[model samples]
Target: MIANEIKKRVLIALLIILPILMAPVDLFLAPNYWVKSLVKCILFIGLPLILNNHYQWVSIKSMLTVTKKQLSLIALVMIATYGTIIFGYQLLERWFDFSMITVQLESSMAITKNNFWFVFFYIPLVNALVEEWFFRGFGFLTLKKFFSRRWSYFLSAIIFSLYHVAIMAHWFSPLLFTLLVIGLIGVGLFFNYINEKTGTFLTSYMVHAGANFAINTIGLYLFGMI
Candidate 1:
């Protein structure tokens, strides 16, 4: 029993620490976008598979399942998310220089007008899947087994938000950065709630995909592709 307890603690610690460590790779170590994506895939997707095989922390089949009710909820959430992001951008763009987002993307990731369509689709679909699997499937659901429900939700949401700070560190002003971090926390919590309802991450993934679609739409406008 004691050995099992120790093993659980160690696994939880690794879950928390690995992501914090990965932040630096996003901020500094990764030389390009593809490299970063590959590294993230290894860390988030590959590592979880290894861990799940050993610890049985989450049921892969359960995490992938989606109900008819969840499908309807997902559609509503996606539409609301899309509208909110688009409207928010329109309202905030006058005050904040969002064009720098495109500038940074081009300079850092080699993203450009030509390849943005590929990136647009990839980010909303693939990136969202990776993140939901990591943060909700592994991070929250797994942690909920060992920790109280509240701690599991809060810790997962916090780590999710902080992890993105490294990714977006240079993208905004200090005030905007602070606001975005708070917003990310809220979004993270809401994602947790969605997953908690469906016993799966697909609901949150759909909502995340919609939000990314809105952001990528804005990106298209910035690139003058629209």
Candidate 2:
């Protein structure tokens, strides 16, 4: 079973790695959106499908049946947490003399336009669905079986941060590393808390996806980062 989980993780890594490899070639071709679309399908859709096969799909369905109270709590927590992160980042930027992170406002701006349905669809599908399924769903559950809950959360967050480091390998900045770690830690804790509090991973999954959507849209509007 352990070996099987390891194999599953390896598969997830491959899905992530494929996009990284394809990115440059796609950029060269000028039809970069197609490459990203395919990558999102493999990483988000493929990974979740593999995970669902390993676990009973019924559990996921059950988890999604959240109460109104739980939904309200999640919304409150997400807002407070999001606010704290924004304030903290702004403070850190001033304290450390670091530049404010640039948001890719282009995506959100384009998304608001009537012509960008494709980008809008991909945002939810690839970023929220695929990424959350692999990292917060599969990765989080797998670690919990091996370690204490807190440890599992931390480890999973660390791995998530590291996995994302692949994209920033060329930049090599300590501040970026710190931000990535902080971001992943926030995501891990928030998601894990939702799972534990609600007794279902899908509760966390919905929050994760919702938070991602909000952040991407808001970030694009405020900071221009996605």
Candidate 3:
């Protein structure tokens, strides 16, 4: 119970801090970019240490179980998801006469200058693994303890969507926000389902990594950002 309470408190604190850390651009360059980075360091780095030390978070081995079929399935799912999104975009464009959807993320200073190695390696491998471990692993499980399964799923999806939007609120349009939120819900469910079925964070990590990698890569190339 105490652990549950601590988990809830941590999540609530994250909820409170993330928005302020990611306020809309105070101009073109966002005056609060440094503050946002500081908050991210605290949440993504510092909070994990505290949780692992104080709450006995799951072991690394337990978090990432490797299996042949699991990895292949993850790739398949990612491909299928990307195809579906492309199809949806086409349909929406045809029906609604919309051109394309685009959002600009604040890339690292080093990455903007064609640092493909840093963007590809750091993003897909390290960042994806760490994010899925924290959000879908610890955050999802902790939320499930206090809420119904449906609510837990919904809440996690909201958090995922909100995190993305909060980071780029300056560029967020209503149409893109809707699409992004819907996409995030699907991604959240996919991760949660993988975690539940495989009973390992590794499986979810693979799926999460695949989805993020596909979308980011495709989006960048298609939108001429790469």
Candidate 4:
């Protein structure tokens, strides 16, 4: 079962990694929006849920059946974190008027205009939810069962960081990439901590969704696209 889970993870990684690898080809050469969306949905999100050998830290029924207490706590943390993200982005933009991060996000602005529904809905909803489900849900939880808890967290953080590295590799400089990796690893650890603390993946998913929502929403505002 463990070996099968490992194999499943490897297969899932290829699903995700191939899209990241072919991003330029997809975006520049062919330019098929639906194809890219399908990859993100089926490969990244769908298969993870269907693959039986891997982790299911929070059962589907539990995810659906959140208690009143869980709902309140999730709302509280999400509100606080959402405020902090807007605050942090505002502060950071003041210092760095132009940034690699901004450049990366600007590229995504086309999606908001071209496919308003996908950007406004899918990005803040499905994309963010599945990422937490995949990285924190599957990666961190599965690793913890196999290794020391700290090692599990550390390996999970590394995997999370490395995944971003593939997506952002060609888009930034060495220095910028290093900083981005460091930042993502920190996010991975924090998300993992919240998952453990709340004893539910919903908190992490909510927070993750909030963060991505802020990024795209604020990016459009700053870029004068909205």
Best by lDDT: 1
- By TM-score, rank the candidates, best first: 1, 4, 3, 2
Colliding pairs, model 3:
none
Deviation from truth (RMSD, Å), model 1? 1.3
For all candidates, what are the clash counts? 0, 5, 0, 0
Error of 3 at 124 (Å): 2.2
Model 1, CA-based lDDT: 0.87
Q: What's the CA error at residue 53 for candidate 4, in Å? A: 5.4
Cα deviation of 176 in candidate 4 (Å)?
A: 4.6
Instruction: Estimate, for each residue in 66-110, the C-alpha lDDT of model 1 and write its tens digit.
Output: 979779979998999999999999999999987788888877777
| TM-score, every prediction | 0.95, 0.62, 0.70, 0.74
Which whole-number lDDT from 0 to 100 does residue 103 have in model 3?
A: 23
Model 4, 147-209: lDDT tens digits are: 578976787787777766545665556765687799989988998887776655677888888
lDDT of 2 by residue, 60-158 (tens): 555446788887887777676557656665665545633222212232122333334455446654566555555655556645654578876776666
Please report, in order, the local distance difference test score of every candidate based on alpha carbons.
Answer: 0.87, 0.56, 0.60, 0.64
Which RMSD does model 4 reach against the true structure? 4.1
**Better model by TM-score: candidate 1 vs candidate 2:** 1
